[model samples]
Target: MRWIAHIIVNAVLLLALAGYFQSIHLSGIGAALVASFLLSVLNIVVKPVLILLTLPVTVLTFGLFLFVINAITLWLTSWLMGDLFTIDGFGAALFASLAISLFHMVIDAISNND
Candidate 1:
């Protein structure tokens, strides 16, 4: 259903990130899928709490701190997946998070139009 499509889009975005960044690596489509699923889960379960905890900092930064939160989530996903999904450093995770966010926004916009 819609959830499956969202996961597949996320996997595709992960593969695209791997193709664009030397520091980002995905073992295969399976790894990308797993990483995407884990990322989604973490975003759902951990992101809200993180945002709540960091609300003051996020407000001070004009909402830019959300990018840091996204990068942390990405790094966590890489850590959970171990070698299968690797982000070399915080820089790479930040860039990957930006790219993934952009792609997801575009995809969501397109889907919403239909």
Candidate 2:
């Protein structure tokens, strides 16, 4: 239900990112969907541990280090997806994470209004 909608939205956002950046490459909608699912799983499982382990750095950076954590997650997603979904470099991964975050915020806000 809600999770399906979120995954679809994330897939759409991934496609949008591919269109927006030359460095971001998505093989197709299928790859985007797989990447989206993997990203969500990583966020749920790996992100918490990462946030806990990096609490000091995150606190020192005033929570900004979360962005780096997100970028790492994105990079991991790309690595896991291999050729299916590829981000050129750390810069591309960072930018893609920011774009995805912004899109997710907007989507969540819109959904919450309904």
Candidate 3:
């Protein structure tokens, strides 16, 4: 149930990103759904390892490097998912990551019954 909720949140974030840019097309809701699922899996299974590997930089930057890690994770997600989840460039990936992070906060708040 928690995983399902996470995927739904990702789907919303992806849709939001699409709305932000006129060039990006999501194919359809189903493609967005698949992208969301893939993103969740990538974050869960791949993110921690990447974070740990970059822990030194994370600490050095006073945790700011986490954002970089997040962007990289999203970029890798785009690669893994290919056409379904396209990120046009680094700037797009960075903004998309930040947007998704903010969206996660919203989801967390709502899920916590706040």
Candidate 4:
């Protein structure tokens, strides 16, 4: 299903980011998978509330504030993951969130995930 594809893609993206960014450290594919799953869960449960709460800022910023919300979610994931998946700080999380968002956007478009 779409969910499986999204998880797999996000895991791959996490691995790729870990490779490219010294600030983001991932233990292995297993960690990536777990992080990916947790991120999916957070997106489903937490992201909506974040979006709603930040609607004014989001709209004011022309929807760019969503990236900040995504960064917060990534930071939360890193916290939940402890040592297995670590991002240096909000800067790294924000960068990773942007990269992940770009990749997901591409994947969604190609797969007609709408």
Candidate 5:
């Protein structure tokens, strides 16, 4: 199902983030899985709300503010899933978001279309 693919992609993204960013800590596959779930939820809910609230700044910055939105989601996921995962600081969160986004892009490319 699409939802399964969704979760798998998110898990892979989280794994890639953990590998790429030293400040992100995932104890094991289990922790990465849990972190992926929280990150997906944060992306689905919190990200849109933050984007809407920061629309003016986002527009002014030519969409660069989306990076901040993404970082906030990373930080939020870290906070909500602290028992399972950990991120050092805003800089780490920012890099994690970037790494995750890039990983997601690669996964999406390889998945079956439509």
Candidate 6:
């Protein structure tokens, strides 16, 4: 239930970001949905390993390096999504990741759920 809501929100966010940022291009809401799901899967399967592998950098940066990891996950999602979803470059990915993370933080804070 929560996951579904999260995915839907992420899709909406992706669409909004694409509209606001010239660097992002999403085919449509369907593409956004697919990209959102892909992101969720990668976060589950890849993000933790990335976190582990980059732990030293993460600690050194006072946890800020997690943003780069998030950007990498977004980049991977765009790569896997092919033409349907695209980010112009790593800078765009970083911006999108930061926006997504901020939105999620606010949502979690409001809902008081993990």
TM-score of each: 0.93, 0.94, 0.87, 0.94, 0.84, 0.97
Question: What Cα-based lDDT does every candidate model obtain?
Answer: 0.93, 0.93, 0.79, 0.95, 0.79, 0.97
Better model by lDDT, 1 or 6?
A: 6
* Candidates sorted by lDDT, best first: 6, 4, 1, 2, 5, 3
Tens-digit lDDT track for model 6 on 55-76?
Answer: 9999999999999999999999
- Candidate 6 residues lying further than 4 Å off, grouped into runs, are none
Against the correct fold, how does model 3 do in TM-score?
0.87
lDDT of 2 by residue, 52-110 (tens): 99999999999988989999999999999999999999999998888878887887798
Q: Give the clash total for candidate 2.
A: 0
**CA-only RMSD, every prediction:** 1.1, 1.1, 1.8, 1.7, 2.1, 1.6
For model 3, residues 1-114, the per-residue Cα lDDT tens digits are: 978977887887788778778534476678788888877777888889988999999999998887777888778777777677677887777777787888788877987995
Please estimate how well model 6 matches the true structure, expressed as its whole-model Cα lDDT: 0.97
Highest TM-score: give the candidate number. 6
Could you give candidate 4's per-residue lDDT for residues 11-51 as a string of tens digits? 99999999999999999999999999999999999999999
Q: Residue 70 of candidate 4: its Cα lDDT?
A: 98
How many residue pairs clash (N, CA or C atoms closer than 3 angstroms) in each of the candidate models, in the order given? 0, 0, 0, 0, 0, 0
What local lDDT does model 3 show for residue 72? 82
C-alpha-based local distance difference test score of model 5? 0.79
Show model 5 residue runs off by greater than 4 Å: 110-114
Kindly report which residue pairs in candidate 4 clash with one another: none
